[model samples]
Target chain A: MNLARTTSTTKGKECEAVPSDGKPGAVGVDPEQLWLRPTEPRRGRRPSFSREAITAAAVTLADAEGLEVVTMRRVAAEVGAGVMSLYSYAPDKETLLELMVDHVSGELTVTDPPSGDWRADLKTVAHLQRAHMLRHPWLPAALTTRRVPGPNTLAFLEHVLAVLRPTGLDGAAKLEVFAQLTAFVAGHVGHEIAQAAVSRSPDRAAAEGRYLAAVAADGSHPELAEALSAPGRPLTPEATFTRFLNRLIDGLDTD
Target chain B: MNLARTTSTTKGKECEAVPSDGKPGAVGVDPEQLWLRPTEPRRGRRPSFSREAITAAAVTLADAEGLEVVTMRRVAAEVGAGVMSLYSYAPDKETLLELMVDHVSGELTVTDPPSGDWRADLKTVAHLQRAHMLRHPWLPAALTTRRVPGPNTLAFLEHVLAVLRPTGLDGAAKLEVFAQLTAFVAGHVGHEIAQAAVSRSPDRAAAEGRYLAAVAADGSHPELAEALSAPGRPLTPEATFTRFLNRLIDGLDTD
Candidate 1:
């Protein structure tokens, strides 16, 4: 497949505007080229590798290592392809990330139809998302940026819209609900993951505890000091997520 | 400042465990060394620059550019210091990021005490954070990772903890609420910024519209089609934020 042919329409001027460094304002993947275009090069001799194979390789690398390590060079090495050849499929890391995000989103398979209870169904959707983000720890950060919904993402979104059907929300409102719910979950899960990491490192956790203790004792933060002194029962990450999720979802008003 | 002397205690085996690529689960900045330790290197002759100057330089670079551009080398150049000398202040980009987050947080000065209404006060806090994040677009992403609180952050946190004092919640729960609120604001601002970027690029926006239209036209996505067709009044990002923030905050139960 001709790489230039695939992305040339949206690649030239617009690409310059889009920082390829994976920041929030970067132009998203061109949906038509990425999701609608043919996976194989139309006019060229068949390449040995598939786009699916490359995306999978990148996802595996991200899952095992981190997003930073899944660079074009590293992903190509993982898939036994030349770095130049990888660009034919994914022009840059940004495009690759879009593919990776949509690829993992395929796992969000919902067989059950909306149970007619919008609040309950929405909560279920959030739980599914929370679990999914935990599985792909990089997702919360990746999602902070805009991603044009690929086929898999669109399919999952369809389910969410259907679940929200009972809310009688207009198209935009329903969409906003989904986006807000997603951002909320992403925020919660990111914090949860970071907190879990702190827990995993005893020394780091201890250092933090001591530091906070010192801060609490500083007299200037009397409230903090009191809060620390009268600590309450600890909640698991899941419990905390559920508590916050219920608040956000249940507070949603159809009117 | 002697970088080795400051960091040696936490830098050896533990540093290996932490991925320095700015992912969650990377050991956070040590609060004692980073915040409590004197800014000046105690043993060595005074360096040409102070840690405050280096942090300010990096913040300026990040404000104009993005976080990805704020490398140790770039920040050093910005401050007119050698990269090696820059290490004395911030050993790595991660540490610099922690500094930047705390530095900008100083802008979040709440002169008026909490208005006794915990919910109203919390809403004010969220609004303040939203404004703060908008000023420094890099903040939303930076906060995704754990940052040990420096003096400025602690001061802001002290104010927030005081606001939550009226909630009658214990210390741990109060702390969790602040963390959750901060995360929520970061997530919302990130989405808002990405959406704004898309709107700024007419070509990208048109392409996206065309792509979504094609998807909506496809018979499989009937709900999406209906929603897009009946798109109601579009809420401004601020309106949307306030709506969701109200839902999250109003639904918080003291129990």
Candidate 2:
């Protein structure tokens, strides 16, 4: 579902904020500058650190300590570069975030081309994303914020687009499918991590179980009570993911 | 899909953090206490502010200034209560957040019981959730953290269970369907809000467009190029939500 509504109130504000460049809502880095421009050092003394090195350090920091710890100063320190030198490459935290996302996206290499069974291939794409996001728990949050794909991210996107090629859906539908799939994976992974954290404590687990049981015993919630009373399956996260993913992809329509 | 994996590495730290009370993550209000026990003021004197009034103030502050500003001090000031006094009801920010989520959930009143067409009814539930989250931009993030359905939240969950009753799925599946649906809505609305914010800036929009155009022209990205070159439809958020929701719900298999 397209949850983004183009309401009149929002449109009014957008109109006033639109810059005079005849470009509407083009507020972030110019894609031309980000994607096409070379990251050459200024014509001066030799550069101390590469953009790739800085981004790798940031990603490493985020993986260990979460995204909040990956500040410009901290990232510079992580790579043993001066903050000023770091700015020459990323300019700001936002740019660094973009760089970090793409740097990690290099991990998403598709060894097999689309299997012609686009639905099956799409599921594989989603599985890869779920695993990737699990490895980088902060990714779901990073992704929800605005980002323009760097070369590595674009490469993964290209692979996804190829996976959807045989579906015969128009380009827009294909793009929407990919976006929806990614959102789904991110959302699921985020929930999974939170749940995992809670599930670790037996005391917490027992308390939660008791609470639900008590709720079921309460007469007012018949349906809830019934549902709680039924036998449950393995309820493993992977199984749950597979079940939900199958429903989502299988239900996709080309028209 | 269940995105949360049970990674053993995380478990070691969690075990250490488990509290001695045999109720580790029971750091939040005990569900039994919250859902069942009354919030009676201490025996000696009357409470200066009702829990509802305090929660309402928190919700109002959140709706206006966003969640970050709805701290205990700010919320206490908003309701003209002392910070210490506010603690009598919601002991901390997490508790206040639980109250706020349920406080707003009072808006989700399902007038009709679920129609026999479970899929159609489930879609309706999702639409309601999407609209609800769009109204409160901070809600998606709040939901991601943690929340046990206080009375208001439980009421909505009860209705969702009723709606899923005819699916012939067991209770666990029904609960899962509801959880997945909520997660999907939160994820979509969160992305929608971010996109809308970016769309308001002409420079950012133009930059993003140019980046895509450049990518389309680059020969390595044939599938992406084809997708980018293809003519697009209205691409409104509501339409997109409906399309994706249909895919998700329609694809759901009970087995």
Candidate 3:
């Protein structure tokens, strides 16, 4: 009946609220009985700053500029709040980084895991993930899956498990399958973007032809050697990517 | 009778050499000449920088400091040379980058392609490549097939091709297989080293625990969730790496 009163510390200060073995306010504080002045039923919230809003703005800034320019003060300014106020939502800059990753994780759209053909389901998931990377190229560098998977990341994991459940593999086998597939997609996707970045680079283009010419003059790398000497057909990144992804998936399906 | 006396242009400079051609310096410059050295080879070169010395110093700099810090000035200082004088050996910074990567390539120890199971041979190449990455962590970021393969890299590729020749995959298929294996290994290795770097960050030790605790809160995703929480059964990088590699290789045996 008097749990709050009985739990007062020896210093006569209100200690951390503890459960009084099912007494009122014991474990769960009831919302209906929150006491307040008649004119205003409850306390007004702090300035409207949710983790979601902060993350969205951070993503925008990162996309517009780059990840290197993402600072706490800049994020706070983007969110229309003082830097100190923003710290209340995210404890530190690192915490903000984690939340930003979680935000991108929320963007992955999952499909109903397929039942009849596991290969199709895996491909669908792979393609969807590729699309996600294209949408937020910065996410991969920001969101790291270390010892734990965040909520949205777990949802992706859940989708993978659901799709793999129909396959004959057990838990360990399924886990291995997911790991390889994710690594394949992430690795390949990273390469694609990096190559794209370099393909546009003037330095890369200027150096590429000259180096090939110099080496092709006398060097011997057989295929490359011959190709360099000849008026060669360079493989398009898209063609290379298509061939690689299909073959890897095909190889995966057989085993 | 003087087929050797012809005018050619290369690098925006007209040259008087042998058979004139449209290509740069294509005055049929002596087929045997590696560098465009001064005619009477500059002797008494012992007191200053040499090409071998510059490349070796650059390789050491990349291995110790990251590639970004391996500036021309810094490298020249390391060799105790005037900055402009260093260029006499390296030609240019791009050439220096190429030489640095080529020097690292020289260390890749590979065997003749195996004659037995194709997948087995592929696995050997994969492991060897992984070892090279560990030996030179800055490599994946610096080197690519588009760049000249250098001598040892060419040998490694030849071994891979020889092994996969029996797999019945065409040129396109061979390229795909190689791309998948190498990109997967590079991305995975980069991710691993990145984790180590992040762990060493002053903030990670403090922030990492919070992120880990929140995500592994539930007994979630079963196997993945289990791996995250199992006491004294921490997933070591080597163990995880081997697991992924085995799965990928096992999946390839069907071909």
lDDT of 1: 0.81
Off by over 4 Å in 1: A1-24, A39-42, B1-24, B39-43
Q: Model 3, stretches more than 4 Å misplaced?
A: A1-51, A64-97, A114-116, A139-148, A167-176, A198-210, A217-219, A226-255, B1-101, B109-119, B138-176, B191-255
> A120-208 in candidate 3: lDDT tens per residue?
77877777777776566655454323323445666677678677656655554565566656666766665566556545554444444
Interface RMSD to the true structure, each candidate: 3.5, 7.0, 14.0
Residue-wise lDDT of candidate 1 within B87-167, one digit each (tens)? 666656678788888888889978998899999999999999999999899899888887788778888998999888878
Q: TM-score, each model?
A: 0.91, 0.83, 0.62
- Tens-digit lDDT track for model 3 on B1-255? 111111111121222232332221111122212233333443544435566677788888777766666888989889888887765554456556766666676666565647678877887778777788877777665543224444455556656766776666555456556767887887666556655554554344434444444444545555444434443334556766666676666666323
**What tens-digit string does per-residue lDDT give for candidate 2 at B12-94?**
12223334332211234444444454333245655567777888888887777677678788888888988877766654566
Sequence-dependent TM-score of model 3: 0.62
Question: How would you class the docking of model 2?
Answer: acceptable
Summed backbone clashes in each candidate are: 3, 22, 0
Q: For residues A158-200, write the lDDT of model 2, one tens digit per residue.
A: 9999988877888887887877888898888877876775677
DockQ of 3: 0.09
Query: Pick by DockQ: which candidate is best?
Result: 1
- lDDT tens digits, residue span A1-255, model 1: 211222321223334444444443656667666666643435555566767888899999888777778888899999999987877666667888988998899999799999999899999999999999999998988888789988788888999999999888999999998888898999999999888888887877887888888777767778778888998998788988999899998899997
